[model samples]
Target: MKKVIPYIASNFKKDKIWMRRTKPSKRQYQVVFAIDNSESMIDNNSGELACEALCLITKALSLLEVGEISVVSFGEKTELLHPLDKPFSDNIGGSILSQLAFKDKQTDVSGMVSFVVQMLSHSRNQSINFSENLQIVFVISDGRFSNREEIRKFIIEAYSQQQLFVFLIIDHPKNSNSILQLQTISYPNGKLTCSPYLDNFPFPYYIILREIKSIPEILADALRQWMEMISSSFL
Candidate 1:
């Protein structure tokens, strides 16, 4: 039989050891997610898909122990569905996701950008601890704008902050003649790239329905994958 060493146990209080190892730190990050809710979005048949995408992102972000997220939606007008000054709430995420189906009658990208600028400005002024990581603004749209000048100003301001990560989710090719020029001009510095169109876009459903009918699932999966890539790179 092999001889075994006698076991040793500590008598020092358990509470002291637990406190030493599990003391919480003040290292939380703020991630702002800005989504579009314009009239065109309603017609794209992607409202539900967009909502699902937002839900997935929110869910994924919730997994991070030191990160906080804010959700905002925009169209001809902007609304702060969830504020950054508070902790993440599942109820808030669900409510904001539901708004994807509530469309605006007009499409105004400039208005949306303006709203984002104002939100960021306020956040900075409030001295919120966004950490040294990044303050992301994920813009999910088809790249259509009404006031190019306003948008330009917004982009310049956001980029000047040097902490803004603009993720443009271009789901489809521009079909509007009025937006064609703006599309070419608004492309960010090598940061903007085209991704697959969300399956719910009404244009392709009739043709592709027989093959894959669940548009929400497809788009959600793509968005989730994109978000996972972002989280892995950042977090």
Candidate 2:
């Protein structure tokens, strides 16, 4: 009987049965916001709207077990407003809004996208189970940007890596060529796929936002919809 007890104890220890624990199957998501802070954003108060939108997004994510978030602003240069290293907070969102300066004339969309892609890529590479994580990017802009080809290349790369890129173009009731150019760059075939009555383009990712007042509702809806899609994929 003593020999039998010792044998069972040794087998259990070898298998490490006591170390087993259940891990939740819920998917984790990493979100990044690339906000445009160019001079044009000052015209319709879009910069402030962008900041409010960020607050709404962070608030929504706080309700879920979503992973960390990062915020980047682009104008004359791309800058990291909120880094992923720090946890998200409403106070942080307020701080980001206070720092917004719409003085730059250039919106380097490509540079901003490149930086986000690299940041998320590095994070994924360091993870042991990266496949369980999803990368999502929300680009809020007035659509006046430079480097069309470069932006398209980075967008394609992000999509190829299974990252979700949602482009929210703030259209302030103008027949602006800059907005049209940005639409073309974002479209897969280099052509506009939306119309006046349409909010979403042929692709599910691109959306045209018209009202600054409805920023919170619109962003919350988009985030919820995308999260649903991501969750469904796991089943």
lDDT of 1 by residue, 141-197 (tens): 544445545666767776566334454443433344222223232236868655333
For each of the candidates, give the backbone clash count: 0, 0
**For candidate 2, what is the lDDT?**
0.68
Off by over 4 Å in 2: 1-25, 173-204, 224-235
- Reference-based lDDT, each prediction: 0.52, 0.68
Residue 115 displacement (Å), model 1: 2.1
What TM-score does candidate 2 get on C-alpha atoms?
0.71
Off by over 4 Å in 1: 1-28, 128-133, 170-235
Q: What does candidate 1 score on TM?
A: 0.59
The residue pairs in collision within model 2 are none
